[model samples]
Target: MPGFVGAVQIMNIGSSGVFHIGDVFQLTPISTAKTFAGAGSFNTGETLTIRNHQSATNTFDNDGIDQGNNFNL
Candidate 1:
């Protein structure tokens, strides 16, 4: 990918389901919700930060996440 910068930065995440890192998310004109390939659970409205995106694995790193930190995709 030309001019590829880094992993995407996400913040202030809240979901009705147990949406966690690694799980792909979707944003539509209606609302936001977890899509395919999610493997974490959390209480409603539990905010989390994820790094190290692996689309093939369909997961991301949720450990030791810093809001401003970035990792390879």
Candidate 2:
């Protein structure tokens, strides 16, 4: 079976996000990060694939890093 979309409306697609209309084989969203005052070495990484798994099979879940102010400045 198939479907149709008459109209699509999107207000805001914030940083490191995705917006889709119809069907898609694969999607890779952008990544973003924020740092406090005088904080350095802010970085982020992502992959839509790994091993024999399909790209769509790799979702963005349980992906993050530990942040703190205990670091020596």
TM-score for each candidate, following the candidate numbering: 0.16, 0.37
Query: Candidate 1 — which pairs collide?
Result: 22-59, 22-60
Tens-digit lDDT track of model 1 for 1-73: 2354467766655542333345345623333333445434332455766543643435555675534313311
User: At residue 29, what lDDT does model 1 achieve?
Assistant: 33
| Candidate 2 residue lDDT tens string, 1-73 | 3568797778888776778767886776645445343222233456433243433333344656655334322
Residue 63 Cα positional deviation in candidate 1, in Å, after optimal superposition: 34
* Candidate 2 Cα errors over 4 Å, as ranges: 32-73
After superposition, which runs of candidate 1 have C-alpha atoms over 4 Å from their true positions? 1-45, 57-73
Top-TM-score candidate index = 2
Candidate 2 accuracy as TM-score: 0.37
